[model samples]
Target chain A: MEWRAAVRVTLKPGVLDPQGKAVQGALHAQGFRTVSEVRVGKYIQLALTAESRREAEEAVERMCRALLANPVLEQFAIRVWPAEQGEEETP
Target chain B: MEWRAAVRVTLKPGVLDPQGKAVQGALHAQGFRTVSEVRVGKYIQLALTAESRREAEEAVERMCRALLANPVLEQFAIRVWPAEQGEEETP
Candidate 1:
Protein backbone atom coordinates (compact mmCIF):
# COMPACT_ATOMS: atom_id res chain seq x y z
CA MET A 1 0.00 0.00 0.00
CA GLU A 2 1.11 3.57 -0.56
CA TRP A 3 1.09 5.88 2.43
CA ARG A 4 1.55 9.60 3.01
CA ALA A 5 3.04 11.05 6.16
CA ALA A 6 3.35 14.55 7.58
CA VAL A 7 6.13 15.24 10.04
CA ARG A 8 6.38 18.30 12.26
CA VAL A 9 9.78 18.92 13.83
CA THR A 10 10.15 21.58 16.50
CA LEU A 11 12.95 22.71 18.71
CA LYS A 12 12.89 21.40 22.26
CA PRO A 13 11.81 23.90 24.85
CA GLY A 14 14.67 26.13 26.18
CA VAL A 15 16.72 25.82 22.99
CA LEU A 16 17.73 29.10 21.44
CA ASP A 17 15.84 29.87 18.17
CA PRO A 18 17.53 32.73 16.38
CA GLN A 19 15.46 32.27 13.21
CA GLY A 20 12.24 32.57 15.17
CA LYS A 21 13.51 35.69 16.88
CA ALA A 22 14.44 37.21 13.53
CA VAL A 23 10.99 36.48 12.13
CA GLN A 24 9.37 38.00 15.20
CA GLY A 25 11.39 41.15 14.67
CA ALA A 26 10.31 41.29 11.02
CA LEU A 27 6.66 40.91 12.01
CA HIS A 28 6.99 43.71 14.52
CA ALA A 29 8.60 45.95 11.92
CA GLN A 30 5.62 45.30 9.66
CA GLY A 31 3.40 46.82 12.40
CA PHE A 32 1.93 43.62 13.77
CA ARG A 33 2.05 44.83 17.34
CA THR A 34 -0.32 42.12 18.62
CA VAL A 35 2.21 39.39 17.91
CA SER A 36 3.91 38.63 21.23
CA GLU A 37 6.00 35.60 20.28
CA VAL A 38 7.00 33.54 17.27
CA ARG A 39 8.66 30.16 16.85
CA VAL A 40 9.53 28.47 13.58
CA GLY A 41 9.73 24.76 12.80
CA LYS A 42 9.77 22.28 9.89
CA TYR A 43 6.90 20.55 8.10
CA ILE A 44 7.83 17.55 5.95
CA GLN A 45 5.56 15.46 3.75
CA LEU A 46 6.58 11.97 2.69
CA ALA A 47 5.21 9.31 0.39
CA LEU A 48 6.17 5.68 0.94
CA THR A 49 5.08 2.15 0.13
CA ALA A 50 4.21 -0.04 3.10
CA GLU A 51 2.12 -3.11 3.94
CA SER A 52 -0.04 -1.23 6.42
CA ARG A 53 -0.48 2.11 8.14
CA ARG A 54 1.22 0.84 11.30
CA GLU A 55 4.28 -0.20 9.35
CA ALA A 56 4.37 3.12 7.56
CA GLU A 57 4.18 5.06 10.80
CA GLU A 58 6.96 3.01 12.36
CA ALA A 59 9.23 3.54 9.34
CA VAL A 60 8.62 7.27 9.46
CA GLU A 61 9.49 7.31 13.16
CA ARG A 62 12.81 5.69 12.41
CA MET A 63 13.39 8.13 9.57
CA CYS A 64 12.77 10.98 11.99
CA ARG A 65 15.29 9.65 14.47
CA ALA A 66 17.90 8.81 11.86
CA LEU A 67 17.84 12.02 9.82
CA LEU A 68 14.66 14.09 9.90
CA ALA A 69 15.14 15.50 13.37
CA ASN A 70 17.91 16.25 15.83
CA PRO A 71 17.09 14.26 18.98
CA VAL A 72 19.19 16.40 21.26
CA LEU A 73 17.58 19.69 20.27
CA GLU A 74 14.36 18.84 18.41
CA GLN A 75 11.19 16.79 18.79
CA PHE A 76 8.93 15.43 16.05
CA ALA A 77 5.33 14.36 15.49
CA ILE A 78 3.99 12.22 12.67
CA ARG A 79 0.63 11.62 11.01
CA VAL A 80 -0.03 8.99 8.35
CA TRP A 81 -2.80 8.12 5.92
CA PRO A 82 -3.27 5.98 2.81
CA ALA A 83 -2.16 7.79 -0.32
CA GLU A 84 -4.83 8.90 -2.76
CA GLN A 85 -4.46 8.52 -6.56
CA GLY A 86 -2.61 11.76 -7.22
CA GLU A 87 -1.31 12.52 -3.75
CA GLU A 88 1.84 10.45 -4.13
CA GLU A 89 3.05 12.11 -7.26
CA THR A 90 6.24 14.20 -7.07
CA PRO A 91 4.98 17.00 -9.35
CA MET B 1 -7.62 37.75 25.46
CA GLU B 2 -4.56 35.92 24.18
CA TRP B 3 -4.57 33.52 21.24
CA ARG B 4 -2.14 31.06 19.70
CA ALA B 5 -1.94 30.42 15.97
CA ALA B 6 -0.17 27.78 13.92
CA VAL B 7 0.64 28.48 10.28
CA ARG B 8 1.81 25.95 7.73
CA VAL B 9 3.47 27.30 4.60
CA THR B 10 4.11 25.03 1.63
CA LEU B 11 5.43 25.48 -1.86
CA LYS B 12 2.78 25.63 -4.56
CA PRO B 13 2.40 22.30 -6.35
CA GLY B 14 4.46 23.22 -9.40
CA VAL B 15 7.29 24.97 -7.61
CA LEU B 16 10.76 23.45 -7.73
CA ASP B 17 11.94 21.99 -4.42
CA PRO B 18 15.65 21.25 -4.40
CA GLN B 19 15.58 20.87 -0.66
CA GLY B 20 12.96 18.14 -0.84
CA LYS B 21 14.89 16.30 -3.52
CA ALA B 22 18.09 16.49 -1.45
CA VAL B 23 16.35 15.10 1.60
CA GLN B 24 14.75 12.32 -0.41
CA GLY B 25 18.15 11.39 -1.85
CA ALA B 26 19.62 11.38 1.64
CA LEU B 27 16.83 9.10 2.85
CA HIS B 28 17.29 6.65 0.00
CA ALA B 29 21.03 6.59 0.57
CA GLN B 30 20.28 5.78 4.24
CA GLY B 31 18.49 2.59 3.05
CA PHE B 32 14.88 3.72 3.41
CA ARG B 33 13.99 2.12 0.08
CA THR B 34 10.22 2.30 0.54
CA VAL B 35 10.25 6.09 0.45
CA SER B 36 9.05 7.53 -2.85
CA GLU B 37 8.77 11.27 -2.31
CA VAL B 38 9.45 14.11 0.13
CA ARG B 39 8.52 17.80 0.31
CA VAL B 40 9.64 20.36 2.87
CA GLY B 41 7.70 23.30 4.26
CA LYS B 42 7.59 25.69 7.19
CA TYR B 43 5.59 25.63 10.42
CA ILE B 44 5.22 28.81 12.42
CA GLN B 45 3.67 29.23 15.87
CA LEU B 46 2.57 32.62 17.13
CA ALA B 47 1.32 34.01 20.40
CA LEU B 48 -0.74 37.14 20.11
CA THR B 49 -3.29 39.27 21.89
CA ALA B 50 -6.71 39.31 20.27
CA GLU B 51 -10.29 39.92 21.30
CA SER B 52 -11.58 36.65 19.85
CA ARG B 53 -10.57 33.57 17.88
CA ARG B 54 -11.94 35.08 14.69
CA GLU B 55 -9.82 38.14 15.18
CA ALA B 56 -6.72 36.08 15.76
CA GLU B 57 -7.31 34.04 12.64
CA GLU B 58 -7.77 37.14 10.57
CA ALA B 59 -4.60 38.68 11.95
CA VAL B 60 -2.61 35.55 11.18
CA GLU B 61 -3.97 35.45 7.64
CA ARG B 62 -2.78 38.97 7.20
CA MET B 63 0.59 38.12 8.68
CA CYS B 64 1.06 35.26 6.25
CA ARG B 65 0.25 37.48 3.32
CA ALA B 66 2.39 40.39 4.46
CA LEU B 67 5.49 38.56 5.63
CA LEU B 68 5.42 34.88 6.56
CA ALA B 69 4.68 33.42 3.13
CA ASN B 70 5.50 34.29 -0.46
CA PRO B 71 2.15 34.35 -2.21
CA VAL B 72 3.54 33.66 -5.67
CA LEU B 73 5.61 30.65 -4.69
CA GLU B 74 3.81 29.33 -1.63
CA GLN B 75 0.45 28.68 0.03
CA PHE B 76 -0.50 28.74 3.68
CA ALA B 77 -3.06 27.54 6.23
CA ILE B 78 -3.83 28.85 9.72
CA ARG B 79 -5.33 27.50 12.95
CA VAL B 80 -6.10 29.53 16.03
CA TRP B 81 -7.25 28.84 19.59
CA PRO B 82 -7.27 30.57 22.95
CA ALA B 83 -3.82 30.75 24.51
CA GLU B 84 -3.22 28.59 27.58
CA GLN B 85 -1.71 30.05 30.74
CA GLY B 86 1.88 29.12 29.92
CA GLU B 87 1.63 29.06 26.14
CA GLU B 88 1.92 32.81 25.69
CA GLU B 89 5.27 33.11 27.44
CA THR B 90 8.26 33.67 25.09
CA PRO B 91 10.55 31.35 27.03
Candidate 2:
Protein backbone atom coordinates (compact mmCIF):
# COMPACT_ATOMS: atom_id res chain seq x y z
CA MET A 1 0.00 0.00 0.00
CA GLU A 2 1.08 3.54 -0.69
CA TRP A 3 0.71 6.15 1.99
CA ARG A 4 1.24 9.86 2.37
CA ALA A 5 3.17 11.20 5.33
CA ALA A 6 4.22 14.60 6.56
CA VAL A 7 7.47 14.95 8.44
CA ARG A 8 8.67 17.89 10.51
CA VAL A 9 12.10 18.69 11.97
CA THR A 10 12.72 21.49 14.43
CA LEU A 11 15.43 22.74 16.73
CA LYS A 12 14.80 22.09 20.37
CA PRO A 13 13.26 24.97 22.28
CA GLY A 14 15.80 27.51 23.69
CA VAL A 15 18.08 26.65 20.81
CA LEU A 16 18.94 29.78 18.89
CA ASP A 17 16.58 30.29 16.01
CA PRO A 18 18.18 33.32 14.50
CA GLN A 19 16.16 33.02 11.34
CA GLY A 20 12.97 32.60 13.32
CA LYS A 21 13.85 35.61 15.42
CA ALA A 22 14.37 37.67 12.34
CA VAL A 23 11.01 36.62 10.97
CA GLN A 24 9.33 37.28 14.31
CA GLY A 25 10.71 40.77 14.33
CA ALA A 26 9.35 41.33 10.87
CA LEU A 27 5.90 40.19 11.91
CA HIS A 28 5.88 42.32 15.03
CA ALA A 29 6.72 45.34 12.95
CA GLN A 30 3.63 44.60 10.90
CA GLY A 31 1.41 44.76 14.01
CA PHE A 32 0.60 41.10 14.19
CA ARG A 33 0.13 39.87 17.73
CA THR A 34 -1.18 36.71 19.41
CA VAL A 35 1.83 34.92 18.04
CA SER A 36 3.35 34.00 21.33
CA GLU A 37 5.95 31.76 19.70
CA VAL A 38 7.68 31.34 16.41
CA ARG A 39 9.87 28.46 15.21
CA VAL A 40 11.00 27.63 11.71
CA GLY A 41 11.59 24.26 10.03
CA LYS A 42 10.93 22.18 6.95
CA TYR A 43 7.79 20.25 6.02
CA ILE A 44 7.87 17.29 3.72
CA GLN A 45 5.22 14.93 2.34
CA LEU A 46 6.28 11.61 0.92
CA ALA A 47 4.54 8.79 -0.84
CA LEU A 48 5.69 5.39 0.26
CA THR A 49 4.75 1.82 -0.52
CA ALA A 50 5.18 -0.88 2.06
CA GLU A 51 3.85 -4.29 2.92
CA SER A 52 3.33 -3.46 6.57
CA ARG A 53 2.93 -0.45 8.84
CA ARG A 54 5.98 -1.39 10.89
CA GLU A 55 8.18 -1.50 7.83
CA ALA A 56 6.89 1.87 6.66
CA GLU A 57 7.46 3.55 10.00
CA GLU A 58 11.01 2.24 10.17
CA ALA A 59 11.88 3.64 6.75
CA VAL A 60 10.47 7.06 7.58
CA GLU A 61 12.39 7.25 10.86
CA ARG A 62 15.63 6.34 9.19
CA MET A 63 15.06 8.94 6.51
CA CYS A 64 14.49 11.55 9.18
CA ARG A 65 17.64 10.74 11.14
CA ALA A 66 19.80 10.06 8.13
CA LEU A 67 19.17 13.09 5.97
CA LEU A 68 15.85 14.81 6.64
CA ALA A 69 17.10 15.92 10.04
CA ASN A 70 20.26 17.10 11.76
CA PRO A 71 20.24 15.58 15.24
CA VAL A 72 23.23 17.69 16.10
CA LEU A 73 20.96 20.71 15.77
CA GLU A 74 17.33 19.57 15.51
CA GLN A 75 14.66 17.04 16.48
CA PHE A 76 11.85 15.69 14.31
CA ALA A 77 8.65 13.69 14.17
CA ILE A 78 6.70 12.01 11.38
CA ARG A 79 2.91 11.91 11.04
CA VAL A 80 1.43 9.29 8.82
CA TRP A 81 -1.80 10.41 7.23
CA PRO A 82 -5.06 8.66 8.18
CA ALA A 83 -4.49 8.15 11.84
CA GLU A 84 -3.72 4.60 12.89
CA GLN A 85 -6.79 2.63 13.92
CA GLY A 86 -6.31 3.05 17.65
CA GLU A 87 -4.17 6.17 18.00
CA GLU A 88 -5.41 9.05 20.12
CA GLU A 89 -5.45 12.14 17.89
CA THR A 90 -6.22 15.02 20.18
CA PRO A 91 -7.83 17.93 18.37
CA MET B 1 -10.11 25.43 22.03
CA GLU B 2 -6.41 24.59 21.90
CA TRP B 3 -5.02 22.07 19.44
CA ARG B 4 -1.69 20.65 18.32
CA ALA B 5 -0.56 21.30 14.79
CA ALA B 6 2.58 20.55 12.82
CA VAL B 7 4.20 22.84 10.23
CA ARG B 8 6.77 21.91 7.64
CA VAL B 9 8.84 24.17 5.40
CA THR B 10 10.88 22.74 2.58
CA LEU B 11 12.52 23.89 -0.63
CA LYS B 12 10.39 22.92 -3.58
CA PRO B 13 11.58 19.91 -5.50
CA GLY B 14 14.56 20.67 -7.83
CA VAL B 15 15.57 23.62 -5.72
CA LEU B 16 19.07 23.17 -4.44
CA ASP B 17 19.26 21.55 -1.02
CA PRO B 18 23.00 21.90 -0.51
CA GLN B 19 22.82 20.85 3.11
CA GLY B 20 20.71 17.86 2.15
CA LYS B 21 23.28 16.90 -0.44
CA ALA B 22 26.10 17.09 2.06
CA VAL B 23 24.22 14.85 4.43
CA GLN B 24 23.33 12.49 1.63
CA GLY B 25 27.00 12.17 0.82
CA ALA B 26 27.82 11.37 4.41
CA LEU B 27 25.11 8.74 4.64
CA HIS B 28 26.32 7.00 1.51
CA ALA B 29 29.85 6.92 2.87
CA GLN B 30 28.46 5.22 5.97
CA GLY B 31 26.98 2.45 3.76
CA PHE B 32 23.29 3.29 4.09
CA ARG B 33 21.42 2.94 0.84
CA THR B 34 17.81 2.74 -0.34
CA VAL B 35 17.69 6.44 0.44
CA SER B 36 16.97 7.67 -3.04
CA GLU B 37 16.72 11.24 -1.81
CA VAL B 38 17.45 13.65 1.04
CA ARG B 39 16.18 17.20 1.54
CA VAL B 40 16.94 19.07 4.72
CA GLY B 41 14.64 21.60 6.36
CA LYS B 42 12.96 22.44 9.67
CA TYR B 43 9.86 21.02 11.33
CA ILE B 44 7.64 22.61 13.93
CA GLN B 45 4.74 21.57 16.16
CA LEU B 46 2.55 24.17 17.82
CA ALA B 47 -0.13 24.51 20.44
CA LEU B 48 -2.84 26.93 19.36
CA THR B 49 -6.12 28.29 20.64
CA ALA B 50 -8.85 29.82 18.54
CA GLU B 51 -12.54 30.67 18.49
CA SER B 52 -13.18 28.85 15.26
CA ARG B 53 -11.52 26.58 12.71
CA ARG B 54 -11.25 29.49 10.32
CA GLU B 55 -9.46 31.56 12.92
CA ALA B 56 -7.00 28.79 13.58
CA GLU B 57 -6.24 28.23 9.92
CA GLU B 58 -5.78 31.91 9.36
CA ALA B 59 -3.36 32.24 12.21
CA VAL B 60 -1.30 29.30 11.08
CA GLU B 61 -1.19 30.55 7.50
CA ARG B 62 -0.11 33.99 8.59
CA MET B 63 2.57 32.46 10.75
CA CYS B 64 3.86 30.46 7.83
CA ARG B 65 4.05 33.43 5.49
CA ALA B 66 5.42 35.80 8.07
CA LEU B 67 8.02 33.72 9.84
CA LEU B 68 7.84 30.01 9.27
CA ALA B 69 8.52 30.03 5.57
CA ASN B 70 10.81 31.78 3.15
CA PRO B 71 8.53 32.43 0.19
CA VAL B 72 11.47 33.13 -2.04
CA LEU B 73 12.85 29.66 -1.42
CA GLU B 74 10.23 27.35 -0.02
CA GLN B 75 6.60 26.26 0.24
CA PHE B 76 4.53 24.90 3.12
CA ALA B 77 1.16 23.54 4.19
CA ILE B 78 -0.64 23.34 7.51
CA ARG B 79 -2.22 20.13 8.82
CA VAL B 80 -4.77 20.68 11.54
CA TRP B 81 -5.55 17.87 13.91
CA PRO B 82 -8.52 15.47 14.02
CA ALA B 83 -9.03 15.92 10.30
CA GLU B 84 -11.83 18.46 10.69
CA GLN B 85 -14.07 15.64 11.92
CA GLY B 86 -14.61 14.38 8.38
CA GLU B 87 -11.62 15.14 6.18
CA GLU B 88 -9.78 12.48 4.27
CA GLU B 89 -6.55 11.29 5.89
CA THR B 90 -4.87 8.67 3.80
CA PRO B 91 -2.68 6.46 5.94
Best by DockQ: 1
Each prediction's TM-score versus the true structure: 0.92, 0.61
**Deviating ranges (above 4 Å) for candidate 2:** A1-7, A11-25, A41-74, A79-91, B1-4, B47-49, B81-91
lDDT of 2: 0.62
lDDT of 2 by residue, A1-91 (tens): 6544566666766788887666657666766554445556665545555566677678778877876778889876676543343221321
Reference-based lDDT, residue A43, model 2: 53
Q: Which ten contiguous residues of candidate 1 chain A have the minimum total lDDT? A: A82-91
CAPRI quality band, candidate 2: incorrect
lDDT of 1 by residue, A3-41 (tens): 999888888889989999999999999999999889899
How high is the DockQ of candidate 1?
0.47
Report the Cα lDDT for residue A31, model 1: 93
Off by over 4 Å in 1: A85-91, B85-91
**Could you say which candidate leads in lDDT?**
1
Clash count for candidate 2 is 7
